[model samples]
Target: MIYLNQAGYAPNSTKRATITGNNHYNLFSADGKKILSGECTLEFDENSGENAAVIDFSEVTEEGRYFFADEDNFRSPEFVISKNHYDQALRDSMKMFYFQRCGMELEEKYAGVYKRKACHCGGGYILGDRFQRRKMLGGWHDAGDYGRYVTAGAVALAHLLYGYEMFPGALTLNLNIPESGGSLPDILAECKYELDWILDMQDEDGGVHHKCTSASFCGFIMPDEDDLDMVITPVSSLATADFVAIMALASRIYHKFDEPYSNTLAAAARKSWTWLIKNPSFIFENPKEVTTGTYEDLCDADERFWAAAEMYRLDKNEDAMKVILGTMELHLSMHCLGWADVAGLGTLSIINSGTDFFGKDLYNRLVMKWLDEADRLKLISQSNAFGITLRPIEFTWGSNMVILMNAMILCVAHKLTGDDSYLKSAQYQLDYIFGRNAMDLSYVTGIGERAFKHPHLRPTAADNIDAPIPGFVSGGPNFRPCDEAANPDNMSDVPAMKRYADDVRSYSTNEITIYWNSPLVFVLGYMNSL
Candidate 1:
């Protein structure tokens, strides 16, 4: 029978008892491949014995075919039920993963740049860490077209996980938006427009030449930051680019799911993939992402890689999993010793796979690695090493991003390994977050150590908790929460709850980020769906 995709795994071992007459079972396929387990004389009897109480012996004398068992469901063997429990457990995880998305907020956008009335200008789709940083004295500082591009890409991802993807919400595929959402010819025109504007802006080598550009869509000028410049370089690996690419790819993925336009998406996939592959910010040593960096500022490269695994499943290319698995192994092997959580991102897609190394052991190792890093000093990455070495609050966003993700990872690990310790560790990390965040979703503006709230600021594409952020008014955002000497006046602030005014959360961050929102959604969805 066609069982739901869930309920596949089952107890592997079962004892076969002889029914006095029939001890044969045959399995056949429509095409004609049939299997017979030969003939073995029945042995044990279920009548009037220790086993008699456990099994029914009423049909003891019948000599005929019995029942059979498959992956998700079975008929004969009572011993094989345990194997399927894991699948049930995984489905239940949807509870946590689904709830995670609730944190994301939609950002209204404007069609044109330079709106005199910033408030009444236009509406944006979603807000991510991309827009949270560049605050200027006169207005909300923007990184220009790059910012818009980043948003466009991120919103796509948000929608993808919000249940728009054709494949499972993993493989990071994308679409090249048409120039205009019009007729077929007009669609081509729109495609040309987007391609011309975005592609032309890149240098001959396919990278943004200027770190800071003007935003035609938002009417603002972007700031030139050192790291932003470092990322577009062909030689270095960056987390920022990968994270932003999620938006574009996710948008296309969602659209494809909505319409089943396989060929159209395939056509648009190349350039975007090219951009991701060639970008320096994303470390790809050993044919996988290797180098690790600030979790907050840089876009994660592996996020797309993780998304690709699910894509392979949907396309049934099976070959694609080779790309997904091989590259991921390369990353995991290279990243195992590092404390940066960015590397762990590559492990996400592998969690549900059934390969030799990936089925179990490898997952456990990753959780252990993250725990070691979070628990120790040298193991911690530069971004997470705040409040002590490495600029105190530099990676406030990154640090928490690492912690929250690792927690989810730990929870999954616990289920797979049957180890409660891992779950304990996951809970600890969540508690670690509450230590500062007040367990509240609002950190908008008027909130603080206990009353931090910044609801007014817009939410970005990546969930703020998971993505890089410059942070709010409290004290830390750009690597440091309270970078006194570096930024004497700079401080991170907690955002207030805009939606739940009566339930004003004293610990929430200001805006909801897409990346941050995705993980939360994933954790709850994975947990609750079970």
Candidate 2:
């Protein structure tokens, strides 16, 4: 979405100026220029009588100027072209949280990499522990600490537009600003405490110890005397998928920005990806072995697909291609058990595989499955006896799986294979999502249903938070990713969601969600080919 240069992150290509009219303001660039409105069909002329604004790139003579989004002048008309493109990049990020929902001015916080779920102009940036903030990505760093791993991904993204900046010790990376304004670790160059701790929890083989964390980082010092008040944890499930999800995210950013991939970081992700692909289980008994468990216990669908998809982006290997195609088929076909029943969410991941596996029969098969499946399921509704879905359980609760991922998948499928049916499916979701946006006509509320809400910051400590956790433990590579893991049924118990709007609400923050954004980038990316 952002015009990252050939060299990764900020390149000489973006130095030139460009223009972005307020044509699609309400729909695309909502809030920031909310008053500016125009139809797509509006003809452009000197006196079009519409919002006629232009981003003049006339000052640029070189490539670097074109790719760079000068922060000091970020809101300048001179950098309009690059800004509009960069703003489009926010579509994916917006899914996670509507960055500009109500605020007229864009917050500098959302300008960089964000790790929170809902950062509308009103709320600023709020960190959400993945499970508590599952509507958001529900990944490892969802806990909202604004730590190092998050910083790495943020830095990589910022590099594409704003290279490492003036902030020292920002929460996210050098490129990204943190909630607390601290610099995060470069997960690519080196594995941070979070990854290492999670890694230590796993066996040398690929089986991930459900909630047990691996302390791969330095010397193990016990917590300070002050930590006695903390609730210790153990046996928490560390999702292999979560690890891969972050890797995939960073991978996409790095690839876009043209940053050199670090060996340790890359190898760690490669190992996780290879193991997950080979074993393909959600439960990580050992990092090497992801054996089957309760269907709901597997890592999030988004993480798995990203693992495969990013690998394809990086290597373009048939093996990785096979893995993505096969995984999507498995979930779509027979895996429609508990949470897996809701068919639409996985569409993005599945269709992403289709796009990557372009020209291949397998890609077509996956797309066909989406069309056929949509027909079989009908529509996503909990009140309806036969809601358009393979499994009712997944459809019952308001897990984001039904809203964000479903629309994303449909659109992606349509984009990958130019079948009108795929477009229809995407429209089906857009119809519902956009309808809600029109109804509220204000901010971007979640689409479809309301997912369960857990505590953003739990009462338990790093050690105590783990399921079947041990007691009285403190300190050492203090972060834990197990909380990001959730069961399929977690969707069903959201009592509070019952009070929210229907299955289709405003487009769930299609602003910050990696799952939603990656597919958007891929789909628009492919469509742009035309």
Model 2 scores a TM of 0.40
lDDT of 2 at 424: 41
Model 2 lDDT, residue 480, Cα: 15
lDDT of each: 0.30, 0.30
340-367: candidate 2 lDDT, tens digit per residue: 2322322333344444445456556656
Question: Positional deviation of 415 in candidate 2, in angstroms?
Answer: 0.9
Model 2 residue 451 CA deviation in Å = 17
Stretches of candidate 1 exceeding 4 Å from the true structure: 1-146, 149-257, 261-266, 274-343, 353-398, 418-421, 431-451, 454-479, 482-513, 517-530
lDDT of 1: 0.30
lDDT of 1 at 445: 23
Highest TM-score model number: 2
How many residue pairs clash per model? 135, 84
Q: Please report, as a residue range, the 10-residue window in candidate 2 with the lowest summed lDDT.
A: 469-478
- Superposed Cα deviation of residue 84, candidate 2 (Å): 9.8
Per-model TM against the reference: 0.39, 0.40
